[model samples]
Target: MCVSVCVSHGICRSLSLCVYIYSNTHSGGGLRWQMAEFTHLVVVKFKEEVVVEDIIKGLEELVSQVDIVKSFVWGKDIESMEMLRQGFTHAFMMTFGSKDDFTAFQTHPNHMQFSATFSAAIEKIVLLDFPVVAFKTPQ
Candidate 1:
């Protein structure tokens, strides 16, 4: 059996945490659980002539305009092995309460409008979405 519970975000619509539990029969029938959050990862190499700050500002605006966007964090690659950088200079990670919320964000009018402008400013881009299975640190 599997179970999921939304523990927080009753008052704050922008942030939430959900716990999922799975029974493991092989491990003496014990239960295992994980914190599940849907994550949208964007890695980009912006056009040399485009103003990157404007793009960042637009992303910040997205979090504010998009209600389903639980949290937004982004950064430039500071120190990584040159060969491993893969021509990607920056990364943006957006967390959502669930994949359904992300789908809503994708179809939102504001996102569609921003996407067109954002896509034009990028020389290269990679977008990935996945369920974040995070484990708590044992204390």
Candidate 2:
């Protein structure tokens, strides 16, 4: 599980604190025990002018076919072109119930098909997988 706090403009400080605690307790796991953690944050970048809707549809289909993905989020970077240059046009935040679930996602046929579709529009892709450390409050 993961917790994301919005620190964007106009968010109240108290509300942010409340959300922080809620996110940590629910998404990041409660004080007693940790929830199932994911081992990676899979991010994909597409070329400019690519059909985003089609890619999202493909991803949705892939997710439906694969049981390994416990939860996920996909979206385009709406910040700026400079941010886009940093890397990745589309980011897919996926949570696996276990390492085994991640492994299954790697080999799943639907994933392979999705990759094929994704590659067609994407000029480049960057994949990063990080090991999970102890959970902390979302910054």
- TM-scores for the candidates: 0.79, 0.62
Local distance difference test, candidate 2:
0.62
lDDT of 1 by residue, 1-139 (tens): 6886655534224344566765565646655555466889999989999999999999999889887888899999999876998888999999887888999999999999999999999998899999865433333
**Best-matching candidate per TM-score:** 1
- CA lDDT, candidate 2, residue 4: 41
Model 2 C-alpha lDDT per residue in residues 1-139, reported as the tens digit of each score: 3444444313222322212222335554544223334555656666778888888887888887787776678777788686546766677877675567788788888887777777788776777654334344345
CA-lDDT, candidates in order: 0.81, 0.62
Of candidate 2, the 10-residue stretch with the lowest lDDT total is: 13-22
- How does residue 132 of candidate 1 score in lDDT? 68
